[model samples]
Target: MTIAVSTIIRPSRILTALVSAVAIMVASIGLAILAGRIGTLGLTPRVLTGFGALFLAFFGFYHGVRIRKILQLDIAGAGQIRLSEQREKRTCSDSDWPHVGKDMQVMQLMPGSTIWPCMLLLRLRAEDHAVRVVPILPDSVSRESFRALAVAVRWLAWQSDSQESSYL
Candidate 1:
C-alpha cells in the first residue's frame, strides 16, 4: 500500500502587511509635520504625505482582515494541493499536475521594493489561466526549506510518471 504524507508550510504575509502599514503611517505623519513646520513646505511633500496616508489606511484595513497562509500537500498521489490564503480558498488535484509546483519560481527582491529584501516568490498555477503568487523567505532565510519543497515536488512528479507508465 502506498502511504501519503502531508506537508504543510506557512508564510508570513499578514504580519508583513501590518508592518508596512505602520512604516507608511510613520512616514506620513513625519512628512505632514515637516510640511507644517514651514510656511510652505512645497507641493511635492504634501502630495507625498497624502499618498502615504491613503496607502497606510488601505494596508491597515488589510492587516485587520488578513489571514494566515496554509498549504496542504499530498505528494504521494495525484498531486493534491490545497491552499487557504486571504479570502480565496480552493483545492486542485489532477494527474496533469503530478507535481504541485512544477513551475515554482523565485525572484530576488531589493530594499524599498514592493516585496521586502531577500524574499522569494513561488508561482503556482491556479484555476482557469490564473496564477497564485506566494512570497516566501522574508529575509535571509536558509534555502534548505526551498530545497525540501523542490525535492517533494520532484518526488511527486516521479510518482505521477510511474503511475502513467504502469498503465501503459
Candidate 2:
C-alpha cells in the first residue's frame, strides 16, 4: 500500500479573483499615469483612476490577508488536491474519501500514503495514470501532508487495479 494525502487543483476561484483585481489595478494605475502626463485629460479621469487604485489597494490587501489565513488551516491544505477519480467534478469529488477534507486552499485525504503541500504544478502517481493535484492555496500546505497524500493515492490505485484484476 502507498497511502497518500491529496489536495485540490490550482486555478481556484479565490486566485482568479485576486488575479482579476490585480489586473484591474494595474490598468487603472497605468491609465492614471498616462492621463497625468498628457495634462489635457480632465480631473474626472484622474479622480476615477485614483478611486480605482484605492479600491484595488484595499481589496488586494484584504484578499491577500484572507487567503493567508485560509492557507493556515489544515482543511485548506486538503482542499487543494484534485484526484483522478473525481476529475469530472473538478474539486474534491469524494466527499467521503477517508481522511479527506478540503477548505479554500488544500485537499486532505488518505489512500495508501500521504501527499501534502502538493503545489499546483506538483504531479503524483494515481491509480491508472500520473495526475497533478495542484495547490489551490496561496500558501503551501504542510510538507508532511503532501508526502502522505502521495503515498496514499498510489496505494489506492494499486488496490483498485488488484480488485479489478481479481474480478476479471
Candidate 3:
C-alpha cells in the first residue's frame, strides 16, 4: 500500500539563524574584498563602503521576509500531493488534477529533490512551468513528522521512477 503523509511546516528559528550567520560572514568577506580593491577600482573608500552597506541591507531584508511563510503539505497514498501556503492551497496528481481554487494551479514534484536527515529540499514545478524550491529543516516540524515525511518522499520518488521506466 502507498503511504500517506501530511506535515505542517512552521517557521524555523534554526534556519533563520543559520541564514543570518551566513549573511554576516558573506558581508564581512565581501567588504574585505571591496576594501582591498578600492584603490584599483578608482572608487573612493566612502562611496564603495556605502554601496557595500546598501547591498548587505538589501540582502538581509529579502531573505528575512522570504523565510516566514507557513506551509502545509499533504501527500496522499495515490501519489497526489497538495501544498498550502497561507489560505491558498493547490493539489497535483499523476494525471490531470482538477483545480481547487481560482488561482490554484497544478504542481508536480521535480527531479533533484533532496531529503537528508536534517533537511529536505523540495523542487516543485507548477502548471505554468515555473519551478519553486522549498526547504524544510528539522526544527520546522515534529520529529515523528519529519521522519515520516522523509520516508514518504523516498517512496514517492521511487514510485515515479518505476512508472517512468515502465513507459519506455
Candidate 4:
C-alpha cells in the first residue's frame, strides 16, 4: 500500500520571528565578544559596536525575507519525495532550472533533518545532487494537513531506515 501526502506550504510568521530572534541573540553575543578586542583593531568600541549592530540588523532582515517563499511538497509512499517553489517570479539571481515549479525526485534525506511536533526540518538531496533545506511549521499549513504531513514524513523516514538496515 502506498500513502501519498501533498501540502502547500506558506510562509510562517512564527518562523520569521524565531529566525529573527535567534539572529539578534547571536549578534549581541558576537558584539560583546568583539567589544573586548576593539582596542587592538585601532577602532573605538562605540564605532565598532555601532557598525556591527547595523550589519546584524540587515543580516536578520535579509534572512527573514528569504524564508518567505511558497512551496509545494509531495511525499509519495515511502520512497519518493518532490518539492517545488510556487513563486510568481524569480526572486534570486540564481537560475531556477531544475526545481522551481518542477518536481524533483529527492535521492536522500541529508543529516540535521529533524521532525518535531511544532516544526519539521527536511534537508533533502535531489537526484541531480542539489540539496535544499525545507523548514515546515504548524502555521505554514492547515492543521489537518500539517498533521498528515508529519505522519507521512515520519513513516517515510522509518521505512527508509528499515530498508537500508535490511540491505546491510
Cα lDDT tens digits for candidate 4, 44-149? 7655675677588778878787768888777766557778777563332224323434344555666568999989988899888988888888888889878888
Candidate 1 contains a number of clashing pairs equal to: 0
For candidate 3, lDDT tens digit of each residue in 134-153?
78888988898889888888
The candidate with the higher lDDT, 1 or 3, is: 3
lDDT (C-alpha) at residue 116 in model 2: 36
Mind giving the per-residue lDDT tens digits that candidate 2 earns over 1-168? 323244433334565566667867666675665468534557887666666766776677565554332222122222333333232323323374443334222233333333334433333443445443344443333355455544555454555568779998
Among all windows of ten consecutive residues in candidate 3, which has the lowest summed lDDT?
Answer: 90-99
Candidate 1: tens digits of C-alpha lDDT, residues 1-168: 333333345546655665667766766675565557524657777676656666676667565445345544343433444443322444333444322454432221112222223454445554444565555553212355444445544454556568779999
Task: Name the candidate, 1 or 4, with the larger TM-score value.
Answer: 4
Could you arrange the candidates by TM-score from highest to lowest?
A: 3, 4, 1, 2
| Comparing 1 and 2 on TM-score, the stronger one | 1
Candidate 3: regions farther than 4 A off: 33-57, 87-106
- lDDT of predicted model 2: 0.45
Whose lDDT is higher: candidate 1's or candidate 4's?
Answer: 4
The TM-score that candidate 2 achieves is 0.35
> What is the C-alpha local distance difference test score of candidate 4?
0.72
Go through the candidates in order and give the clash count of each. Answer: 0, 54, 0, 0
User: Where does model 2 exceed 4 Å of error?
Assistant: 2-40, 70-118, 121-139, 150-168
